[model samples]
Target chain A: MPYPEELVSPMRAELTRLGVKELRTAAEVDGFANGQKGTALLVINSVCGCAAGGARPGVAMALEHGTKPDAVVTVFAGQDLDAVAKARALFAEYPPSSPSLALFKDGKVVHFVPRHQIEGRAPAMIANDLKAAFDKHCAKAS
Target chain B: MGTFHHDTHELHGITCVVETRGPRTWVGRVHEVGPAGVLLHDADVFDEVPGGPTKAEFLARTAAVGPWPRHKSVVVPAAEVTSVRRLGDLSA
Candidate 1:
C-alpha cells in the first residue's frame, strides 16, 4: 500500500522545491522519458533511509554545480507506482532500484547510480559523484 | 528431498542474505531470480564502509535482531552478486 499523501508531501517537496518536475503519472513519465532533448536527470524517488539521507540531498547539491542536465525530474516510488514503473522501463539494462538516478542524453541513458551507491555514502560524496557525471555528460547551465 | 537448482526458484519467498561484489549486502524475501539477477522485496541493505562492521559481524547482528528494512524492493545484478544464503541458517 502507498503511504498517505500527507506523510509523503514533504518528501515530494524536497526535489520540487529545487525545480525538479514531479511526474506523477505514467503518461507524464512517457512524455519526459521519450523524445528527450540534450540531457535529463530522472530520479526514482523513494521514502527509504538512503533516499532521505543521501539521494535527495546529494542531487540538490549536485545541481548547484555549473554544468548540469538540461532538465531534472522525479517519480516517487510506491506512491506513484505506475509512473515509477514507466520510468524504470527506460533503464531496463539495470535492475529496478529506488533512489536511483539516470542521466539521459538524446533519449539514451549515459550514466546511472543504483541504490547500492547511495546506501552508505554521505550526501556530499553522492553530490561529488553526480557532479562528475554532470561535468562529463552535461552542458554548462545557462 | 527433490533436487532443484539452488540458485533459481528454490529461494523465492525465502528470507536470504545477499552479498554483492561491492560494499552492499541485502536481507530480504526473494521475489525473483533469473538471468538478469535476484529481485528482493522488503529488503534491508547494508553497505559496509572502511572501519565499519565486517560483513560477518553485520550478518550475525542482523540474525540476532532483524533486517533493517531500508528498501521496499531491490535487485542485485547477476554480475555484482557474490553469494546468497538463508538468513535463518545464521547463528546469531
Candidate 2:
C-alpha cells in the first residue's frame, strides 16, 4: 500500500529539507543524468528502520562536508519504480539495491553503497562512511 | 534468501516493482520496506485522492505482493528487483 498523502508530505519534506532532489519519474532520472554536467549522487530511498535510523541522516551529514557531489538526488524505492529502474541501468557493474547510494561522475558510476553497508549502524557511522567516499570522489571546486 | 538494503532516513520514499508468487506484478512506492513485509504505497490512478489513505490501506491489504511479513530489514533479494532508480534528489 502506498503511504497516505498526509503521511507522505512530511516524509518528502524531510528529504527535501536535507537537499535531496526527488526523481518522481523515469524521465526525471534521465534528465538528471543527461542534463546535469557533473557528478551526481543518486539515492534509492526506502522505508526501513535502518534507513530512518541511519541511511538518510547519514547521507545528510555526509553532504555537510566541503567536498560533495555537485547534485544529490533520490528516488523512493517502491514509489518510483520506473525512475529507480532507469537509475539502476546506469549502474551496470553492481546489482540492484534498495535504500542504496550510487555516486556518478560524468554519467558513470564511481561509487556504490550497497545494502550490506546500511544495515545495523548509527546514522553518524553511515555519515562518516559517506564523508569518506565524498572526500575521495566529490570534487573540491564548489 | 535475497538481500535488500534501505537507508534509515529515506524510508518513506522507496518504491519498487514487486513480483508475487504467481504471475502478478505491480508498481508501488514503499511505505515501509522492512524485514517482515514491504508496506507498499499502491498507485491508485482512479481515486479522488490519488495519494490518500486508500493507498496505505490497499498496501496493508494486498496479499499478492509478499512473502508474508519480513523479519529484519535487509538488502532486497536480487531476484525481486528487475532494476532500481532514484525518484529525485531534494535540493539542499
Candidate 3:
C-alpha cells in the first residue's frame, strides 16, 4: 500500500522546492521519458534514510554545478507507484532500487546510480558523483 | 537425512533492529521473510558513519524515544544483513 499523502508531502517538497518536476502518474512519466529532447535527470525517490541524508541533498548540491542537465524530474517510489514503475522501465538494465538516479540524454539513460551507491555515502560525495556525470553527459560544446 | 529450516518467520510481525554488513542499520516491524531478504515496514534506516551515532547509541535512543518511521517498506537483502534482533530486547 502507498503511504499517506500527508506523510509524504514534505518528502516530496524536498525535491519540488529545488524545481524538480514531480511525475505522479504513469502518463506524466511517459510524457517526460518519451518527449524530452535534451539531457534530463530522473530520480526515483524513496523514504529511506539514504534518500533523506544523501540522495536528495546530493541532487540539490549538484544542481549548483556549472554544467547540469536541462531538466530534473522525480517520482516517489512507494507513493507514486505507477510513475515510479514507468520511470524504472526506461532503465530496465538495472535492478529496481529506490533512491536511484539516472541521467538520460535524448531519451537514453547514460548514467545510473543505484541505491547501493547512495547508502553510507555523504551528500557531498554523491553530489560529486552526479557532477561528474553531468560533466560527461550534459556538457555542451564550446 | 533431516532437513533444517531457518526462517525469519518467528520475527515476522515483530519490531526489529536489523544490522547490515555495511554501514546501514534498520529499525522496523518485519513484514515478510523470503529467500531474498527480510522486508521491513515503517522502517527507519540509518547509516553509521564517522562522527555519527554508533549502533548501540542509536538503539538506545530508539529505545528511549521510539521508532522513527521513515521508510514505508524496504527489503534488506539477505546477502547484506548481519543481524536482526527484536527492538523490545534492547536495554534503554
Measured against the true chain A, the candidates' chain A TM-scores are 0.97, 0.90, 0.96
Model 3's chain A TM-score stands at 0.96
Q: Could you give candidate 1's per-residue lDDT for residues A38-126 as a string of tens digits?
A: 99999988877668888899999999999999999999988999999889888776667677799999999998876656655788988
Model 3: clashing residue pairs?
Answer: none
Q: Give the winner by DockQ.
A: 1
Ranking by lDDT: 1, 3, 2
**Model-by-model DockQ, in order:** 0.05, 0.03, 0.04
Rank all candidate structures by their DockQ, best first, as comma-separated numbers.
1, 3, 2
Tens digit of per-residue lDDT, candidate 3, span B54-90: 8788877665434666888999999998988876556
The 10-residue segment with the lowest total lDDT in model 3 chain B: B1-10
User: After superposition, which runs of candidate 2 have C-alpha atoms over 4 Å from their true positions?
Assistant: B1-92
Look at candidate 2 and tell me the lDDT of residue A96. Answer: 61
Output the number of the lDDT-best candidate. Answer: 1
Two-way TM-score contest, 1 vs 2, winner: 1
Per-model clash counts, in order, read 0, 62, 0
In model 2, the Cα lDDT at residue A130 comes to: 79
Position B86, candidate 3: lDDT: 75
